[model samples]
Target: MKLPLKRLLGIGAIAAIVIVIDQASKFTVRNALAIRETWTPIEALGDYFQIVHWKNTGVAFGLFPGVGWIMPFAGLVFLALIVLFYKPILNGSFSFAIAIGLQLGGAIGNLIDRLNPEIGYVVDFIWIWKYPVFNLADCAVVIGAGILLITLWKSDLAAVKKAQPSESGDAFNKNFNAASAADKTHE
Candidate 1:
């Protein structure tokens, strides 16, 4: 079934915003710094927080490197699954929509980099402590997944509560038991 135009537009807008910001930040970093160059804005926090120009040909946090060619295919499959199973997102609350949008935007942002003939790797700049260098797209994807988990947890709790027998049901059972006892006595 077709989704509501308004809802689709809202989700699309969120995704577009993520893509634009992610791409723009990556572009800025690539132009401003040479590859492997680091820039620390705060002197004291330099060791903890800094931006560096790095490239990852693999998935998040540079995992499974040298498999860049397969990423595009995996991304395409991800997009297809999102489109095919969108009913749950559409029926879910606003948070669910936001989660979906963030995920889509992140996936597309990385896909764009992988598709680029000139730079067939994702640009990552943000650096925090000893963590692997990452980018805004990665952040969005992680945050989106977190939100999705929370929403699913809440929905499960609601379902469980609904499935439990109500107080009225308990009262009815009590009355039926009493009637059955009376009938046995009469018999």
Candidate 2:
């Protein structure tokens, strides 16, 4: 379905905001924090916030290997997804689009740091796990992914519910059976 032009533009604007916020925060952190320095945890709901200086050559929570040679490969994946899913970003619900924006923004932000830095590692300077230190870009990527997963789950559920009754109807059942059989035959 075609999205209203206004909504489309709004989503674009929100995405822009994500990019701005993500980059600006990273820049601020870079300027303010000393590398490898850990600050006292900033308490929130249960001791979840803090600002420090850290870097990761790896992926989510520093899971993968070091910066090594994987940075460009991962960056390519990010770019591909953004390009492949551009339609969803433009046409999906407002929240979903914002989620995409956050994901994209976070990815691009970290990629910038990794690509530009001498060691090519993303600066990651916030920790709550006594965990591998992370930064705003990491937060954006995680939260955005969560949002995407939730939205996809919800959409799937909706589709299932919407399909069930139709599947039971006599005419729909006939058409569905034929379609299913046809699909099987093609496979």
Candidate 3:
């Protein structure tokens, strides 16, 4: 399917928003907090939510601790793959476009950090309960993936419903087969 210019623009706009928000938040945290510093937890929420200053050299939630070197390359490849498969991935679905936009923005936002030798790490600050501290980019990626998964699941279910024979159709086929068998035996 040919992607409409309007849809492409819409997706680009969403991606820009995600990147801006992610980068701005990261910039703010980097400037305001010392490394490893944690602000007091929200009083009403107990330890459920707080801001911290931490550096992550790995993927989301700080997994793969020392593999930072590969992130920028991976991000580049990811973006390229998105462009190569843009039509199929979006499939003219607005929700899929939005989801892909979020993923793309997140990938770019973190890629910038990985490529910045001065920083050499992504800034992460959001902490909630026992969850690993994360940042806005992570949020965008996660939400995008979730939206994609749900929509794909719903589409699959719809396809299955379409493929399956309806109850009345099934009944008619069964009756026709039985009638044919009886007629053959009598003849």
Candidate 4:
């Protein structure tokens, strides 16, 4: 439950960066699409990617629509994950910590977006091949979560292997040594 000062500080800093990037990109998109009025596809991967503008009032992939209550619910889940995983997340491994950082940072980013908007709409502007529009934060969260799950699964497998009774020579060495000592005393 305890987090080292360095980790706590690193988490805070990354979260702040996420917020900044999310808001800045949103503002730019809003100005271009609303205030200044439009951007064409920044580039095209033969219909694979584009930079477009859309507003989403739901979780990733536009899962909900017009459900006003879900934003805060998403935010709560976000907060809970960060708190629950903080310590092991910090101590675990490289990929583990980075994945957690990405998740934590992305969560904070979207949560901030929902806080002030009139209907809790998030500004989403990235366009990917035939997919629902999303923003930087969404990408971070999804990729991070995927990596985190993979790491957890791998570690669980490793622990299981280690706990199995193995054929190694050191297996129960101390126990056998103690038994031999007792036998000598008896003789």
Candidate 3 lDDT, tens digit per residue, 4-39? Answer: 676788778988999999999989888888999878
Error of 1 at 134 (Å): 0.4
Candidate 2 backbone collisions, by pair = none
Tell me the TM-score of model 4: 0.74
Which of the predicted structures, 1 or 2, would earn the higher lDDT when compared with the native? 1
* Best of the two (1, 3) by TM-score: 1
Cα lDDT tens digits for candidate 4, 1-187: 3555666666667666776887788877876785223355554464777666676777775667667357678778868866776666566666766676777778777777778755267778887788888888887788888998888667654544444344775546644554554334323
Report, for every candidate in turn, its global Cα lDDT versus the true structure: 0.82, 0.67, 0.79, 0.68
Highest lDDT scorer: 1
- Give the winner by TM-score: 1
Per-residue lDDT tens digits of candidate 1, residues 1-187? 3555656777799889999999999999999999999999998999899999998987887888887778889888988887876665565678878898898899889888889887789999999999999999999999999998887667655544445345777755555555554334322
Q: Could you give the candidate ranking by lDDT, starting with the highest? A: 1, 3, 4, 2
Q: Give all candidate RMSDs, comma-separated.
A: 10.1, 5.5, 9.8, 9.5
Q: Which of the two candidates, 3 or 4, achieves a greater TM-score against the reference? A: 3
